[model samples]
Target: MTSRNWLTTLAAAALFPMLAHAASEQQLPSEEGQLTVSTVADGLRNPWALAFLPGEQGMLVTERPGNLRVVNAEGKVGPPISGVPKVWAEGQGGLLDVVLSPDFKRDRTVYLSYAEEGEDGKAGTTVGRGQLSQDLARLENFNVIFRQAPKLSEGNHFGSRLVFDREGFLFIALGENNQRPTAQDLDKLQGKIVRILPDGQVPKDNPFFGKTDVRPEIWSFGHRNQQGAALNPWTGKLWTHEHGPRGGDEINIPEPGKNYGWPVATHGINYSMLPIPEAKGKHVDGMVDPHHVWEKSPGISGMAFYDNPRFKAWDHSLFIGALVPQELIRLQLDGDRIVHEERLLGELKARIRDVRVGPDGYVYVLTDAKDGALFKIGLSGG
Candidate 1:
């Protein structure tokens, strides 16, 4: 066998001795049976997000330290690509997410979100678009498309997740920047979901357009640090997950012009263990309730709608990565509601940072660690 195959076989043998016995006995699950997990790529530094190319030859992955690497199907990591913008690189800051444009095959354009340093020593989440060079080893035409206005000094809460809807509109999730009162403010983009054209212009039809009280880009407000956001492929609804203080992590269905109770109303307490008054009722009138809430936070990170057919049973379900719980949580959806949730791969003992369905219909996971790894979940046998 080739060296690469030999190495992979050796690694698999060492990591999962159970595979050997099962393979000999032909006792592996069929295509629709129990899930098997295997490491695909390794030796990464705090890998954050992954985006599959159109043909699935490889994927682009982001590292929190501002590096991007291409991992091929064989689990080989390429040299870091150049032309990434400078980032603040402080606590919970630095490189965040990488996503392909809706027309990636035609345009070769990619979008990135990071915590950028401002002139006055402040840092805020910024989104930029760039084209992959002909050789695919570098980036060109890099330009900042969107930046948080009136950047704040605090680095604690930059939401920085990007997703595109069926209408080709871009939505960016922004946090309160560790300023509790800002969640209630309508003038700033902080603590709000902003909708814009792919090129970053505020859509005139936006809910607050021409309104003096709210920022023109604001679609919804009152969010904490919404680290995870995705477009539900089945319903085209925007779903998001935000980190709460001591407890009360939330999963919300975001709607335009609506307010999601953050500090003003939450099921959670402050980091100091103090209580914030709940919204007048358990479910407020103007605000939306999470489809589900985590009373004990698991430090949720990235989320995506499972669109691949390989796992037919998982269609329309939402997969979220948990940092503290160190597992991948799958929430089954039944007509815009979560019917069930199953936590997978918790025994692997890795902090999952992001989850994506590969073009091949396999589930790919990016783990958070100093020497992080990319893992693939698939059926062992058929």
Candidate 2:
């Protein structure tokens, strides 16, 4: 953490597998080994998400300004693919996460989430899906699948992270739209995680499907801004991390119809240094508590699990990307609990947006900036 150590780490980065952008390689020490953070592609505009396409084609990256494009294996970026919906790109609202269908190889379908503009210029989160054309230049038959209910007039906190479980159910993360109280409102879709079938229909077995006076799509409630979500491949349960108020960021294993107690059971206070009026000091009688809470936030963003043995030391570690601190974090876990935390990529100075572990056994991260980039994280000398 000293200047001399930081400089030494940078000097060591020159030894990574020198791809085209090798000159700017950055390095940092990891508990497992030394990590090489090298740009795989560049010239993107505020990329928010990434998904590897099937058949060795490449990766699909979604930019915040309403563009989706491909970054090929050789680090070549293709033109923006056509047919993406026009986004209400303002104040943290824009095109967001992209993911392939569980049956992508057969269906050639991809899903997209973005901030959709409404009447009076209000915006809210919306999800859609389309089949990628054979030539990769356009999307065909794209249709809106889900939209956040009661769209708010503000733009911040439009959480749009996406994840699909093995059962082919799609889960979408929605933020509370900066309306703090909305997070705990059972009747509202804001600040909730919702699940639907591949075609965007409510599954009959959904926990709240037959309930009254609530959005049937909601799987769980009381989240703030959940920008990171993934399924624990071992347990088949959904795991997510969310941005809390000034502090109190949390990690929760979202279960059916559970109340996460945002605003009511928070360990954080308002950014203005005022105690939240509804907070009951981090616990409420009927709500679930977070498995882990960061009293001093790192501005958590994207996350992914490293289960591959390619890097033995990184096994079972969850890699989290941070924005304000401009770093990547490694959270080592034992069973259901986080056992250790290691911070990396702090010196890179870019808002770490999304992180993904690729089939090739390398971890990929996207940065948030005008000339954002995709980076590959790997160990040196491996």
Top of the candidates by TM-score:
2
lDDT per residue for candidate 1 within 1-382, as digits (tens), equals: 4566456545643443322222111122322477766777789998988887654347799998999888865677899899989888888888998988999878999899999888888888899999987667988889999998768846679999999999999999988888777887899878889998888899999999999877899999989898999998778889899998778889999888988887777777767776665434346666777768988998999898887544567777788998898888888888887888888777778999999876555577899998998887766531
lDDT of 2 by residue, 120-229 (tens): 68888999999999889998899999999878838799888999998889999899888889888878889999999988899988888988888899999989999999
Model 2 lDDT on a 0 to 1 scale: 0.86
Worst 10 residues of 2 by lDDT: 12-21
lDDT of each: 0.81, 0.86
Model 2 quality (TM-score): 0.93
How many clashing residue pairs, candidate 2? Answer: 0
